[model samples]
Target: MVRFVDVPRMRHWVEERGVETVIRGIAERIESDFRRWPEFDTQARVASHSPGGVVELMPVSDSRRYSFKFVNGHPGNPAAGLQTVTAFGVLADVASGYPVLWSEMTILTALRTAATSALIARTLARPDSQVMALIGTGSQAEFQALAFRALLGIDSVRIWDTDPRAMDTFERNMRPLGFSVHRASDGAEACDGADIVTTCTADKAYATVLTDDMVRPGMHVNAIGGDCPGKTELEAAILHRADVFVEYPEQTRIEGEIQQLPEDFPVTELWRVLRGEEPGRTSAEQITVFDSVGFAIEDYSALCYLDSDLGEGEAADVDLIAEPADPKDLFALVAAGANSTVRLG
Candidate 1:
């Protein structure tokens, strides 16, 4: 029996434990795994792009466990009364290659993404930073707001979105959580006097959500929207000005904001920073950017954490794998189930 946590069960688990607690736990796990970054086999996700959106398979493994996620991104999904992104994942035993856990990763992805942003910002953002300029108040807006507040002690957020309804929703949702939510008329206005600028728009084309002129000195940019080829939030000029950090350079050059720059443009891997091999925020005046293209190892960590947490709970179980009574006589097992004792070997 494989443990399965569908959407409803996952929601219940999160609600019972609280979002902040769950996110913080996941963040701790992610940071812990990142410290041992050299142990895992990592690679860029395999993506299938269409005119509407992209479907991706992100996989990672260590010596003990293998994990993968199937996810999709479609900006037009909201208009069709669907989510912009949805995902599911599996965790399996490496030796037997049998699934040990199955889970709905749509909510998990949001949680992990927000946790990752906060984890990175803790290193890249200034120590005194409290104000955040959150552009694009969509599905991920509230999650980012909460993570930053919980992890970085941010007390205020100035948010902006092209869709007024979405901005209103973000404000309504975040204010109850004790955040000073401010609505801005434009992206530039949202970024004013802010220490961290997070762009999380859902668009399939290159967008100038944050221009170079709007950015100030000594600011940290959490760029999470430009996760696929040809989909970006910040302008090319901003990339030229900021010192960028990424998950994997080869993958980020193909899918992240760095895709807009020359092939040889310099960027640092974030794990190196976590391992103290590279500097994160060198000085007070230097601008830092975490060009976030969600990596597979992050999902690996999340799955591992969930598997441990859900193991003791009364989570539902599904018979995902068939068991043969005799290892070598698989057909005999099927024949027995059909009430026929056939002698066929």
Candidate 2:
């Protein structure tokens, strides 16, 4: 039997452990895995795109375990009373080639994405940064806010969204949690006087949610949206002015904000900075951009973290693998069922 965490159980786990605690744990796991960047197999995610949105499979593995997440992003689904993104993932034992855990990843993805953003920001953002300008206050706003607070001591958030209801939802959800939420009239207003700027809009087109004029020196931009071939948020000028860091250069060139630039444009992979081989923030007045496209290894770390904290009582067991009583007698199980039916007849 394989351990399973369905949507309800996953929600329960987060509620019981507290969201910030879970995000902190996942962030630590992500940092640990990134520090050993050479130990895992990493690659760009396999994507199937349509006019609506895209579906992707992100896979990564170390010598001991393998993990993959099947996720979809459909911007129009919200109008149809569905989530814009949903996902499921599996962790397998490499030696046995059998799955050991299966989990719902929609919530976990949100958690890990926030964790990764905060983790990189902690390294790249200015040390005394406090206020964050959140450009898109959709599904990811609250998690981003919480992660930044947990990691960077940021409690004040200036938020803006094209949809008024989204901004309202974000304010309603965050204010009671001891957050100082300020609704901004536009993206520039949101970004004004903020130390860290996070853009997470969901449009699948070449929409410039953040313009060049909005960004300033001494700020870190966590661009978590615009994660596909043609989707982009920041102006190309922003990339030109800021020093960009990415999870994987190969994948970022295809699917991140850097896609707006030339193929030969320079970028630094984040793992190198984490390993201390390269510098993160050389000066307090320099602009930094984390061109996050949601890499596979982040998911692997999140899955491993969840698996480690799992308890038998809270999780269900699923009979996903068929094991024969004898290794050479694969047909015996089926034959036994047939014989029992014949006897009854």
Candidate 3:
């Protein structure tokens, strides 16, 4: 049976307990996957970009299971009373390619991105770093802040956005959990003198949110935007100046900040650092960049983690597909379930 978990159900599952556990699990899984980096299938995300927005497919699998997410980004959607992005994903059996579970991923995206940011910072950011700069306040802003506060020891953020209303929404959502949140006038102002600078802007164009002039030595950047083909945040100059780290080199090279660089441009994979095959940052003065175009492996890691820790298989499941008792009688189940004795007609 194909099971369905809607957005509300997913939100409860994630916000209540599932998200933190999945993030921690992914961090551990990533570490182990990196230790044996050659074992799994990895590739650049498949994208279909249109004038309306972009839809992307991220697929990844190990020997055990496979997963994929179908996600789209449309900034103008808010005007239509929908979100900027809406998503759903599937978890499937690797051996037979049969879908095992499906869930809404709008909230999951926010959680996983934040989780990834925090995970990368834990590895590359300075040990004593407790402050961060969050540019682009939107639906994702609060999640990023909470994830950092939970995963790292982040205590403060200089928040800035092109839209003050977004900042207001972010601030309001975060009121219950107290943090030293300060507002900044612009992206550069937010990034100034920060230990970790996170960029989560939603624009689909090439906009330079951070110039080389804004960067301080030893700062760790979690570049979350510039994920698609034409979108980018940091100026190309910043790439030249920073020592870059990425989730997967093959994917990052085509989809991440390195897309701006030459074919032979050098960058380090985060797994290598996690695996101790490469150094994170050699000195306090060295700039570190995490060109984060989200990866499918992270999502796969998340789903398996959720599946395992859902407490005695307690996640609600709904029959989203017709089940036939006889394998060849495809129409029987639909016909049987359709007959109703209480029809008003």
The reply for model 3, stretches above 4 Å from the true place, is 18-22, 34-36, 312-314, 320-345
Candidate 1 per-residue lDDT, tens place, 292-345, comes to 989998899888888887746647899988788877877875675674467776
Tens-digit lDDT string for candidate 3 (26-89) = 5665556556666778877888988989899988877878889999999788889989887788
Instruction: Estimate candidate 2's alpha-carbon lDDT, on a 0 to 1 scale.
Output: 0.95
User: Using alpha carbons, what is the TM-score of model 1?
Assistant: 0.96
lDDT of all predictions, in order shown?
0.91, 0.95, 0.80
Question: Clash totals for all models, in order?
Answer: 0, 0, 0
Report the CA-based lDDT of candidate 1 relative to the real structure.
0.91
Q: Distance (Å) between predicted and true CA of 16, model 1?
A: 0.9
lDDT of 2 at 67: 99
Look at candidate 3 and tell me the lDDT of residue 129. 84
Residue pair clashes in candidate 3: none
Model 2: how far is 169 from its true place, Å? 0.7
lDDT of 1 at 27: 88
Where does candidate 1 stray beyond 4 Å?
A: 336-345
